[model samples]
Target: MESTSPLFALRNVTKVFPGVRALDDVRLELYPGQVTALVGENGAGKSTLVKTMTGIYQPESGEIWYDGQQVTIRNPEDARQMGITAIHQETVLFDDMTVAENIFAGSYLTRGRFGNLDWKAMNRRAQEILHDIEAPLSPTAMLSGLSIGQKHMVAIARALSVDARVVILDEPTAALSHHEIHELYELVRRLKARGTAIMFITHKFDEIFAIADRYTVFRDGAFVGDGRIEDVTEPELVEMMVARSLNETYPKVEAPLGEEVFRAEGFSHPTEFADISFAVRKGEILGFYGLVGAGRTEIMRALIGLSEQARGEIYIEGQRVSVRSPADAVQAGLVYVPEERQQQGVMLDMPIYQNISLPQLHRTSRAGFLSTRNELAVARQYGERLNVKTSSWSELVNNLSGGNQQKVVIAKWLATHPRVIIMDEPTKGIDIGSKAAVHAFMSELVQQGLAVIMVSSELPEIMGMADRMIVMNEGRQVREFTRDEATAEAIVSAATGVRA
Candidate 1:
């Protein structure tokens, strides 16, 4: 395979940060019309390799090959010109711009004579691209008004508009629904039929097996293995991801749930959620399963007092509690780990110690002065417990990998010792190895008598970890399932309000 000529290839790519060697002696090949699935643990140098190939990062030592010819891509424009384009894990679209405007952003269509913007032609072209992808969205619609799945489709449309020969999709289905994911698969098939090579990066093994023709596994900044998708079992892939056999990924522990630790009654928030009610006991994990607009996040936000217009009765430890703000919720022994980790969870520019200690500043301060010793001690403790990969606690959070950054966020909350924790899409963009680590941590937390309310889109995670599950549909709790009773079909039916 290595001897065969590839349409696109990365030869011995290496990237280094201050103390971190992000990628080391890595190599990959993307054959024409083949979808290669990139798999690894978070921080396994997957992002670094992609960034290097896409011109977000210049490799310290390596060569990129296009059609058996060596090339150096210095910027995104250069990569695009060379028929390389990447759709990031996070959708990068202008919220204020229309779909057509965003699709043709830097290179807008111009009319004859004067260089006037050709709005009609641009919209028509955008509509044509969307039609090709089978996406149900208007070209004139504002990006902010679209769902996460819709935003993802728009990104794909943008990539297709460039007529890219090699398309890289990073965690494309992290926020998409089953129907939308099917649409994406169809689009990928069409692209492949047209002889376009694809590099797909995802944590979902099911999707990988479904769409990928070949697979590559990365571990700790190095390539471990690559082969045909049919040649590998799910367990084998899992072992390759973590570099070890995982005995039990979920590792459920039985703990007697105590009286209700947190309760919401008649919770209502306009446009977000309404008429939601549930109770979570100590030493229990209450998993919430829903589609993108099923009001899972809105309910969690209301519980943490992030929604101003939220109206409800919240009881903590059987005592009525009123949370008017985030501070109020924190004072009441409740904390929220937001879905957008970069925007809300941690301060990227700050050091790990500072970010970890931010949530509990008052505890680490003496008479309004922060105690550096206390901060460092706390950060080091949680960092080690979470297995955060870093040279030191003084390292910046942004410098760490996606999974390590997530650990820092969890460590920040754990430092505060909240009784009830609401986690929104905790493992959304993380790799399978880090995801298992997080699942283990959650199980441990519940065993230690902490109550957890987890909102997730992945059915397997919910079924495996939750003691009880609640399915939401369009802001309503349509069904509930015990750990023994929940199945993929049942959960999907409940979430989509579809009878089965």
Candidate 2:
């Protein structure tokens, strides 16, 4: 069958920043009634291509064709005018506004003769859009009152309300549950049926096979592969994404666990979670498993001193420590890389060197005078060690790819030289190649006698890397398994409260 005419096409596109060519001679096509999966390793220019398509950045060279006609998308408003909309990985919602208000923030409906605002019409339309996405929400509901999943639904409703012909979803399911992902897939199918073209950007291979009809791979700011989903194996796609073989992606390491390095006893927090306890031995990796709301993250936060109402006895190196804040946790040799890297992990506006040295700034300074040379040395050492693909230490963190940004977060924590590292969803939303790199780094840390506690939602990841596994259900620990005992079935049964 002849391929359907592309609703949009980018030819010979090139985007350049001060010292970086984000995208070079990249070509992509989006067909109506089909979903295209955009795949690549971090700093491979996936985001840059998306930005160019969404009018966040203008290409230095090339043409964008929509409906077989050349078009100039100068701004986001222009893109929206042309029936294109983007739902970014990081949600952009007005927290204080109601769902309906946020849905029509920049463009609100107007009523009768007096030109008064049509609140009723707006609410009804918002409700209709939310219902179309299978989101259970009230138009009057406050954005601040919703969970991360709910907020994402609101964003989707807003996008649907625009009635866009081309929809771009950047890691939409990153923070959603399995159930919510199903709902999203249903909505996406509906959109496809209505002839909407979708550019689905994600690192989850399972999702690509499940939702995408076609695929495009990016490597080092260039197009590496493009074909139908059925024609590409997951391994082939991953290889194209990183431009390397999987066998060589991760480094080799073997850890020999020693005596207990840190312990949490009877940890509890009222709203977030309750009655959590775990221990990490030197040179060991303890994995935490649960659904999105299963208190895995809550317990991690409490253990890392990011929770205010948390009550627990934290023992580090056989000495009891009081950790009331992140600073306290760092003082106790406990470092946490938060889930939301952009918001909590790195300073997007700051240079890479500054962010890498943020946690250990005191170590690089004397008499209140910061030492640039020391900071540069530390940043360079860890940056290269972590394989952060950046042009220079002075490059802004935001300029790097999602995977590289994550590496910077890891680098920052490593600068502190912590005894115990708590990584919450460390590999979440990263490409397969980057995921393997992160896994290799975790193994290295364990071999170096650094106790690591990882909270992850991906079953395969937990099964592959964890030395020990702890499953949580409804705010309580349900089961523990050693590496040999841990399996996908066992972890799922324990996490879902189903007896095996």
Per-residue lDDT of candidate 2, residues 1-500 (tens digit)? 43479999999999998877889899999999999999887778988888888898989999899988999999999998898998887789999999999999888899889889899999999999987767889999999999777887888788777888999999998878798788778888988987888999988889999999999888889888798999988768767877667565445466998999999999988876777778899999899999878898888888777788889899999999999888899988999999989999999999999999988778889898899988999999999999998778999998777788999999999988899999999988887778888999999999989999998888878777788999998888999999887778888999999999
Candidate whose TM-score is highest: 2
Q: Candidate 1 clashing pairs?
A: none
What does the lDDT come to for candidate 1? 0.88
CA lDDT of every candidate: 0.88, 0.88
Report the lDDT tens digits of candidate 1 across residue range 317-349. Answer: 989998999988988999999998999999999
Task: List the candidate 2 regions with Cα displacement exceeding 4 Å.
Answer: 1-3, 111-116, 131-136, 246-252, 270-275
List runs of model 1 lying over 4 Å from the truth: 1-5, 60-62, 96-101, 107-154, 270-275, 498-500
**What is the TM-score of candidate 2?**
0.91
Query: Which whole-number lDDT from 0 to 100 does residue 405 have in model 2?
Result: 92
